[model samples]
Each structure stands twice: as structure tokens, then as C-alpha cells.
Target: MTRAILEPVDADIDPRVLRDIYGQFPSGVAAVCALVDGSPVGMAVSSFTSVSVQPPLVSVCIANTSTTWPVLRAGRRLGVSVLGEAHEEACRRLAARTDDRFRGLDLHVSGNGAVLVDGAPAWLDCSVEAEYPAGDHTVVLLRIAGFRIDPRARPLIFHRSGFRQLVER
Candidate 1:
């Protein structure tokens, strides 16, 4: 077995280089959304992850400067939809800085007011469990209330700052 050597990092790290380095790891994209003030508020996140199974916890990182996170956190429940491979356009639309983020997409709203995107591979209905500061972004911990998965769909992958589809070998 070969062991890799480790090196110490410098204090000054270029944000662009850091982003590029992080982008090397492919991750699934998810639409984090909620109904706020009688409307749907959402944002696309590549940082969604499952944290715990005992309490059904999941998390998504939101930028500290995000205007949408404020509105989303005010809602009782938040929705997380794992985008499908065919949802590249929808993901772009959801991430755009526009008034109507949910403008031309099929949606499903839960009784607690989580707005879920249609055709997503999976959906998670959650409530904010906790939040912690993490550099320029806020790590939001969500406690899952309910969830569903579609067997026929595949997740949308974000790699090197672009959308990618997985090929079955």
C-alpha cells in the first residue's frame, strides 16, 4: 500500500482556486425550497448531504450573504428535491437572481408548505434543526420529516462547475 504525504496550506488561499479544487469532486445538486409569504422561495445547492439516520438529519450549506436563505428559514418546513439528470435547465432557472424562481416548473407543495420540484429523483420534507457558522457560508442542519424516492430517475451531478449525467457501467 502506498501512503500519500501531506503538506501544510498557506493562510491566503484564492477563492477561485478553492472553488475549482472543490469542484473536482462531483456532487448531486438539490433544490432547497420553502413557501414564504405565500410564495415559493428556493435556491440550488451542491452541498446537500445526509448527516444522520437515527434522527433523519440532512444538511445544505447556504451562503451567508444569500437573500433567499433568510426567507426560507422563516418558513415552518423546507423542501429538498434531488434534481434529476434532465433538470439542468430547471436548476439554472432556480439559481437565477429573479423574482419568480418557480416560474415555469411543475411543483408539489406539502401541507406544511415545503415546495418541491416535480420530476426530481427524491424529495425530503424537513425543518431546520440547527445552524452553525462555517466561513462564508452557513451550515444548515435539517431534520427530515418525510421523504420519497423515484426508482426510475437518476441524480443530477455537478462537476467542474457544470452539470453531468452518470453513465452506468
Candidate 2:
């Protein structure tokens, strides 16, 4: 089978237009959190992805201007909670610019300072393995140390600038 070949556009792409085009594909949402200075710091990211299995590596791309990433990165370990379909509110709260991101959410703090959100479909305790600058965002490589999964949970999704859930066919 042959793939379609497209011609390149002559004009520069608009960020908003590019984002809208990229949003056509759905992605699962995850909360990246850690206990920093006795406070839980977290953020919702849709760019989380599995990188490798041999080293149990995962990755998340965070904007360079994010204040939360700096705090969360300083921790010895970071908690990656794959938000379930029921966590739409929790996801939004985590993404907010409030003093306390865990205000109304159920969470558990690990001995290593990873803050896991309760009811998440999956949770992973990881350490920052590597980081690289990718344009305006930073690519964070996480080396998973430990993890847990709840097979029954459906993951929360982000699509076209809206929250969504996986559907069973």
C-alpha cells in the first residue's frame, strides 16, 4: 500500500490552527504530581506516553513557562496518575493556578514524596531520568520505579479542547 503524499504549505502555521489540527486525535490525561516543600504540586498533562519497557520509562512534555513543573521536578520521586473517566474535575483542579491543587481531591503521599491521586486508573512512582528542550516545551523522561494498575477503570481523555472518556465497543 502507498501513503498519500501532500504538498508543503508556503505560509507559516498559526499556533491556534496547529493546535486545532493536532486536537483531532484524542489523548489520555495524566496528573503529574509530587510533594514539594510539604505541599502537593501537580499538573494535568495530555502528552504523557510510554517510552520504553526495558528501563520502564515514560515521558511527558511540559511547557517551559510552567511553574508547577519546576517544583514537581525537585522532588526525589514523581507520582504519575493516569486519570480515570471519573477524574474530570480532579484533572481541571490540577491544571488550575491555585495555591492548593489537591483541595478537594483524594490523594495519597508515598514515602518518597510521590503524590498519587486516588481513583486513578494507574499510578506510577518515577524519577526524572532525563530532560531535553523540545522547542517551547521540555521533554521529561521518567524512569518508573514502581506502579499499580486498576484494569476496571476507564481512562479520562482530552480531545478537541474538551474532556472525554473511552467508550467500549
User: Which tens-of-lDDT digit does each residue in 22-81 have in candidate 1?
Assistant: 999999999999888898899999999999999999999999999888888998899999
Candidate 2: where is the Cα deviation over 4 Å?
A: 1-11
Tell me the lDDT of model 2 at 54: 96
lDDT scores of the candidates, listed in order: 0.93, 0.92
What TM-score does candidate 2 reach?
0.94
Who wins the lDDT comparison? 1
Model 1 residue 78 lDDT score: 94
* RMSD of every prediction: 1.5, 1.8
* Candidate 1 regions with alpha-carbon error over 4 angstroms: 1-8
Residue pairs of candidate 2 with colliding backbone atoms: none
lDDT of 1 at 54: 93
| TM agreement with the true structure for every prediction | 0.95, 0.94
- TM-score winner among the candidates? 1
- lDDT for each residue of candidate 2 in 1-169, tens digit (9 for 90 to 100): 9999975655677788879988998999999999888988889999999999998999999999998888789998999999999999988888999886788899998999999999998999999999999998999999999999999988999999999867679
Worst 10 residues of 1 by lDDT: 6-15
